[model samples]
Target: MIEFWLCAGLLLLTALAFVLIPVLRGRKLQAEEDRTALNVTLYQERLQDLQAQNAAGALNAEQLAAGRDEAARELLADTEGAQALPPQRTLGIKVPLVFALLMPLLGYGLYQHWGAIDDVERARTFADQPKTIEEMTARLEAAVKSDPKSAESWYFLGRTYMAQERAADAAQAFERAIEVAGRAPELLGQWAQALYFAGGKQWTPQLQALTDEALKADPAEVTSLGLLGIAAYESGQFKQAIGHWQQLVAVLPAEDPSRQAIQGGIDRAREQLGEPVEEAAVSAGPGLTVQVALADDLQAKVQPGDAVFIFARAVSGPPMPLAVKRLTVADLPAEVRLSDSDAMMPQLKISGFEQVQLVARISRSGNATAGEWVGSSLPLASKTTEPQQLLIDSADSKAP
Candidate 1:
């Protein structure tokens, strides 16, 4: 700010010079013009005295003429040689002075109106290096208060809060950051991490949602992979933790400080499982508990041996099921659990989607893709905790 004022003052001074220099020169020229006028008046008086002497017979004609000529020569010498000056320019000091004063005032006014003063203040707020994590967190909190619209400020504040283990505050800050900066993968991961910690690392459906959404946006998002691994490890799913951490390690830079810690975590997971987990370990997401029953009217329509296929598919993604479970009409009114352990493929699981649709179909033709009777639940979170009840009453005449 001091430098800013210094530069502004210099510019204002330059403008004043432009306005005042000409006014000062005009004053000098006016003085010379006054002297020239005085010389002309004196010359006229001397001529008049010479004519009076000639008329009064005080001097001969020659003397009178010589006296008049001498006056003229003196006038020329005084006016041209001593008092000569450039032509006078019309100048009003009042206007120039007014403009000179207004120059600085106007500059200051415009700066106050449009300058990036808030940005400067934000810089200052962050410039004072903090000696400890607490100090850094306080500074970042101040910065965000000063500039609430700055997404960058909020992000750093959230990270600092995380370092302090203030998970709820960190979650709020990260949510604000995402609101301002858009749902970029990195921001989403931070939001998920904060929420995950805030909930005591219980790995709620919402946390799973945030992480899944982040990974969907960016497959190699390191933060999402790390959080997923941590959640799996917490839930005693060491094989699944190994799979997620392996993916995280593959994308991390060789020199990254977290790389060693992540590798250590992976090693621990392997030891827990007593083996090097392969892709097979990837099938470790929580199962969905559901009660499926035949509608009273459709009880006769479904045969006892008719294959009942229960599956989960992303609400807005590929047609393939993330996980599936097979049953029969005889299993109607039975409780079943569909899980990643029942994944249709090694690479796909319920954990891959933020929201999922539950589907149950009676494929009498033995074609799982095209069935005779099907029922579907509206999209629910993939990690929904409470058991869902579904009725198999709808026709599945439409093509898949």
Candidate 2:
């Protein structure tokens, strides 16, 4: 701002020079005009003296004629090199001074009302690279506030919010971006991710709709596919997770930094389901029923779409599940049966375990192997006819 004012003041002075130059020259011309008039007055007075001398009879005719000729010569000499001056204008220094003051004031006033000073400052601020994410985000927030309809500003703000883990705010910023910039598929995917995380990693119909819409618009939309994979994996739908992740991987360039992580996730998912990477998965099982219900104390804190993993494992054996079934909080207090079809491997079966432990876990991050809540039943014989009751009333013994 100081720099701007300095430059503006210099410009105002430059303009004042134009007006001041002519006023100064007019004063110089006036001085010349006054001297010319005084010379003419003195010439007339000399002629008057000669006439008085003639009237007093102090000179002869020849002498008077000689004197008149000499007087004419003197007049010519006095007036030599004089030219007629043009009529002076009534222009005054006061008018120029008033103009000088008004020119700067009016110009400065108009500029303040509609100038790029803010933009200039913004540019300068950015040039001095911000040292932190918080600083950069602060600048973006101010930019959007000043330009509410700038789609680019909103987009970057959303990304920054996402990086800062303010998913809800990120979601709002992406929505504003789409409203201002149009429904680009990438924007939709980002918006969906923020919405998904903002809802505590629960996959709702709204989130599903957003990802579905994004993929429909651009089949290879990476964020949408990655989100779907996350949702599927957390819900213990390993095959579906593999499919989404594989698709995402295929679309990504080989040099992409995310490809390795995503591929690792796919491999982990396939391994969890005991499916060979080279072959498609097939289901088999020794089926059994378990009824799952959340303890009343925990019902208020969980999402309906949160992943629920139910499985039966040998009481004291390999520690691996013989059979597993996936559901969600929405299916609570309901009986879900796992069979040989739910076996982690082609050979593993619930029928192999004479005594098994039935377990249910609710994972917020979509990882069936780990979660925030868990419930299990005491050892029961495979021949046991009663329905096993599982209560997800306690915190999980593991972390995601």
Candidate 3:
């Protein structure tokens, strides 16, 4: 903010210089003209005295002629090298001087009305990572204040408020986001979640309506699915809870950490209804088991946190993965199962393809399509039940 104000001050000074420099020059030219007029007046008075002397016979004609020549010479000397001045403008100097005086005030006024100085300050504040939740909340609040129309800002601010357990504030932030960005399915889901918490976790018609609207727009919307499951469980609707959670489990990626918690909720709901827990039912699908390991030489180059993507891609169809599982380099040498339930999309599943290629890639940046190290197996039957060995043993020549 200080830097912004400093730059503005410098620019204002430059503008004043442009306006006032010419006015100063005009004043100096006027002074020179005044001096020339005085010199001409002295020359005229000397000529008049000489003419008076000649008329009184106090001096001979030649003497008078000499005095006249002297006066003329003196006059010429005084006016020598004077350039003819251009016609002066009636308002040039005065107008610019007045404008120069008002420029700073007018600029400040216009800027206060329309400038993005607060945005500049917010940008500078956001450049550095916030070290605490309070700091993060403060930064996010300022960001929304600076750019109320920025749906992204409002969305993140709402998320931050949620983290801080300020449910009411979070609800308001999400509402603002919906106003700016429209009722996007994700935003609707978040807004419903916030409102539910803000209303003391009690299920309400408003909450139900919001979730319904969100799911109507996007059936796979995760937040609404989870929130609905929770509400059903709390209300003793075990069967409804199970249904909602199962749908959520189906849409979530296989490697999502939240899957375990959600599955726990499903099992609890089933137990509440006196049904036997069925773990296999959740993951039952055609799958390929693979043992993945990092290359010995490249192990030293990778960090424990580096992302390892293990997936199967169709050999004769689209390049998109049939199924995928994500892990970290620290989890290398571990066995993973890529199954129909792990499919990236519902229509694209391991069972849908005839032949597939198994791939293991290590990416420092967590991108599945491109990575630093990769290994792949030749095309094989998608229904192959045998476990296979895959290694990240080669540099990824196709990495971008």
Question: Highest lDDT among the candidates is held by which one?
Answer: 3
Residue 111 local lDDT, model 2: 92
Give the alpha carbon lDDT tens digit for every residue of 1-400 in model 2: 7988899989888898998888898777787777778877877787777778888998767877788788778767876776678996757779987888799889988998998776887687767644445676798899888778889889988977775568999999999999999989899999999998899989899888888889999999999999999999999999999999989878977545356557668878988988765432222123566888999999898999998889888786656566677788998888877655456544456677788889999988766567999999889886566667788899888866
**Best model number under TM-score:** 3
Each model's TM-score? 0.53, 0.55, 0.64
- Model 3 clash pairs? none
After superposition, the stretches of candidate 1 with alpha carbons farther than 4 Å from their true spots are 3-7, 38-83, 88-91, 109-129, 142-150, 202-206, 235-242, 254-260, 263-400
Model 1 / residue 165 / CA error / Å: 1.2
What tens digits encode model 3's per-residue C-alpha lDDT throughout 32-123? 78788898999989989999999999999999999989988988898887767887765657689889989999999999999877777777
Ranking of candidates on lDDT, top first: 3, 2, 1
Show model 2 residue runs off by greater than 4 Å. Answer: 34-102, 105-115, 147-149, 277-400
Q: Each candidate's lDDT (Cα)?
A: 0.80, 0.80, 0.85
Q: lDDT score, residue 196, model 3?
A: 94
Worst 10 residues of 1 by lDDT: 276-285
Better of 1 and 2 by lDDT: 2
As a whole number from 0 to 100, the lDDT of residue 32 in candidate 3 is 79
